[model samples]
Target: MSFLQLLIIAIVQGVTEFLPISSSGHLILIPKLMDFPDQGPLIDVAVHVGTLAAIVSYFWRDVWGLARGGFASVGIGTAPAERRLFWYIMAGTVPAVLVGLFLKTGGYLEGFRSTTLVAINLIVYGVLLGIADRFGAQRKSFEELTLKDAVIVGLAQALALIPGTSRSGVTMTAARFLGYSRFESARFSFLLSIPAIAGAGLLAVLDLADASARMQSDAITAGALTFVAAILTMVFLMNFLKRASMMVFVVYRVAMGVALLLFFA
Candidate 1:
């Protein structure tokens, strides 16, 4: 990929990864629309690693707590709230990991990357998110999350394996429907993503074990660039949700989906 292509991938992935928009959908569309060479799974892994790092950095406190809690659950210490949350996250991650492994090994994942499929999902799931945000109660906080809530959101996240379903979007939509506030919803979604992204990246790395040096260099560069963009995006988004609704993202998703449908038609 050229510098411009790399930059565009970084910006798009970084900006859309945490938002209620689908980064994978945009990444898939860009190469098809612009006739750019596919950056391949290596670059995909690189950008994912970058965003993973960003979320981890931004939520280091939560990560640390989760770590301690994880240990505690195994009888190392006692952190009731943290231990509960740690287990909840583990339980939540199960559905997606199982589904992803099935799709990957079955060679069925790539078939869902069609632009029409992406467009439909973008519109449908976006509207679902809008409805959840508009009508769902918002009285719950992060600490109030239940095991049922985490499992439900995790199942919803499994749907994001399809292009344009938007992992963050679906998880947040689920959280909202469960009556959590936007900030708390987004926080849980972001935290849930740590394991998801890491799992995906590990799979991709297995494919790149024999990649060329130049490809490795490009991956490193893309990762660094995406890390910068992703962290900034994470900061902006967390703060923005504190005082705003997600209607703007809903509108954008609908408009973009409509445009893609028309263009593809």
Candidate 2:
């Protein structure tokens, strides 16, 4: 890929990955719309690493707490609340991992890559997010998270395996419906992405053993650019949620979905 194409891909992946907008949907549409070459598994893995680093950096405190809690759960420390939160995150990741594996192994993942499906899901889930945000209670804090709620959110996240269902969007929607504030909801969603993104990057890496030197160089550049963009985006989103509703994202998703459908039609 040319530098311009690489730059655009990194920006798109970084910006959309954490937003309610669907990164996978946008990535799928990029080549189709712009006639750029497909960025293969190497790029995918690189971008995943970038976004994963962004999440980790943005949530370092929570990550550290989870680490201590995880060790403590096995009798090493004394972080009861942290231990509970750690397990809750683990519980929330199971459904998505299983469903993703099933889709990959069955060769069913590619079937959902069409723009039409992405467009439909964009509008559908966008509206659902709007509805949940507008009507659901938002008094609960992150500390109030429970196992049942985590599982429910996990199940919602599995739906994001579809092209435009948006892992972050669906998880936030589930949390909204369960009465979490928008900020807390987004926090949990982002934290839950750790294992999911790492698993995906590892799987993508399995296909990279034979990557050429040039490809490896490109991957590193892509990863670095994506990391920069992703960290900035994460900071913006976290701060935005502190004082704003999700209606802007809802409007954006709906508008983009409608435009895609019209253009494709």
Candidate 3:
């Protein structure tokens, strides 16, 4: 891929990573449509690493609070709110990790390369998010989010490994389904992504470690660009999603899905 191609992919990575669209699905489809060979490890890692950085930077305060709470939980200094939140995040993260492992290790999500499946998943999940948001009880806040609820939300996040199933989409959908207000749902979804995305990025890094020698290739350049794009994308979405309707994302996913089907097939 040329610098331009990498830049384009980076933009896709950034925008989709947080906007309730499927970054992986777009990455796959873009290459297929352009007849580019399978994207390389460098690009994937770069964009994700960038995203990781973005998330950490954006939520440093929350992350710090969580970390402090975690440490305090073992001592006598922790506030009840901090202790509760720390445990809740851990509770939520477990199901997400387990689900991700089951799907990845069990071959349930091996269809990431299939554009048709991705397109279908995108439209279906997008619709689900919209519907869930519309009908959600919208009564809960992050403070009120329960461990039981967190685990279920995490389970929903696990499904995001499938291309077209946005991690944020599913998490927020689950939150809304369980009665979170839009802001609360969106906030928790982003919070939930911190651990899941971190784990995924770490896994990707480990996988890429075996290929670091090729980091000088064009693909690496593409990956760096993608990373920059991913960072900016996360920043924009986290800010914009404060009041954005889930329907807006749904339309984009459906349109993109149709486009993928028409053009890639």
Candidate 4:
């Protein structure tokens, strides 16, 4: 692919990966809309790794806590708060991984990339997110999250396997419905993303081992660009949601879905 293709792909992947907007949806539609060539296996691996790096970097303290907490939780009879959070993240990650594996094995994941399907999900899930945000209790913090909350959110995340059903968006929506504040919902969503993104990237990396030298070089360049973009976007989004409602994202999704229906469908 060309430099422009790499740049656009990197920006889209990095930004949308953390945002409530579906990264998969954008990755699917952007290329079709721009008539860009397919982003091969190497670039796919690069983008996933880059975004993964950004999230891990931004949340290093939490990541470290999760790591330590994981060890503690495994050995101890009952986990402390840190260890509990660690297990919660792990628990929250399971449903998505299982669903992803099933979809990949069935060859159904790629087939869901249709513009019409994405458009419907964008609109429907956008409204669902809005309803959850508006009516949700919004009283709880991350510390208040329970095992039930984490599992329910994980189950909601499984739905995100469908195109336009953003992993972050669905998880946050579920959290909101369970009474978590916007910032807390976002915090858990980002933290939960660690395993989910890493798992997906690891699978892609196995496929990328056979890439050409040129493709590998391009992947490195794209990875660097995506890493920078992901960091900036993650920082901005986390802080933005602290005070703002999720209506902005909801409106954007609906508008984009309508546009896709009009033009692409």
**Total backbone collisions, model 3:** 3
Candidate 1 minimal-lDDT segment of 10 residues: 203-212
Q: How does model 4 fare in lDDT? A: 0.86
Q: Please identify which of the two predictions, 1 or 2, would achieve the higher TM-score against the true structure.
A: 1
Q: What is the C-alpha local distance difference test score of each model? A: 0.91, 0.90, 0.76, 0.86
Candidate order by decreasing lDDT: 1, 2, 4, 3
Q: What overall lDDT, based on C-alpha atoms, would model 2 receive against the true structure?
A: 0.90
Candidate 1: segments with Cα more than 4 A from true spot: none
Can you write out model 1's per-residue Cα lDDT over 1-265, one digit (the tens) per residue?
7888999999889999999899889988989998999887679778988999999999999999999989999999899999999999988999999999999899897798689999999999999999999999989987887899889999998999998999999999999999999999999999998898999888767766778888877888888899999999999999999999999999999999999999999
- Provide TM-scores for the models: 0.97, 0.96, 0.87, 0.94
| Model 3's TM-score against the true structure | 0.87
Q: List candidate 2 segments past 4 Å from native.
A: none
**After superposition, which runs of candidate 4 have C-alpha atoms over 4 Å from their true positions?**
40-42, 74-79
lDDT tens digits by residue: candidate 4, 27-66: 8887798989777545765787899899889989878878
Q: For model 2, give the 10-residue run with minimal summed lDDT.
A: 204-213
The C-alpha local distance difference test score for the whole of candidate 1 amounts to: 0.91
Q: Compare candidates 3 and 4 on TM-score and give the better one.
A: 4
Clashing pairs in 4: none
Candidate 3 residue-wise lDDT, 1-265, digit = tens:
5666767777878778777787777777777777776665456656766666666777788787787888889995767787788888888888778877777687665456798889898889988988997788867888787889888898898787777788878888899899988777877887887777788777776666676465546445655565576667666665675757678888888888888778667
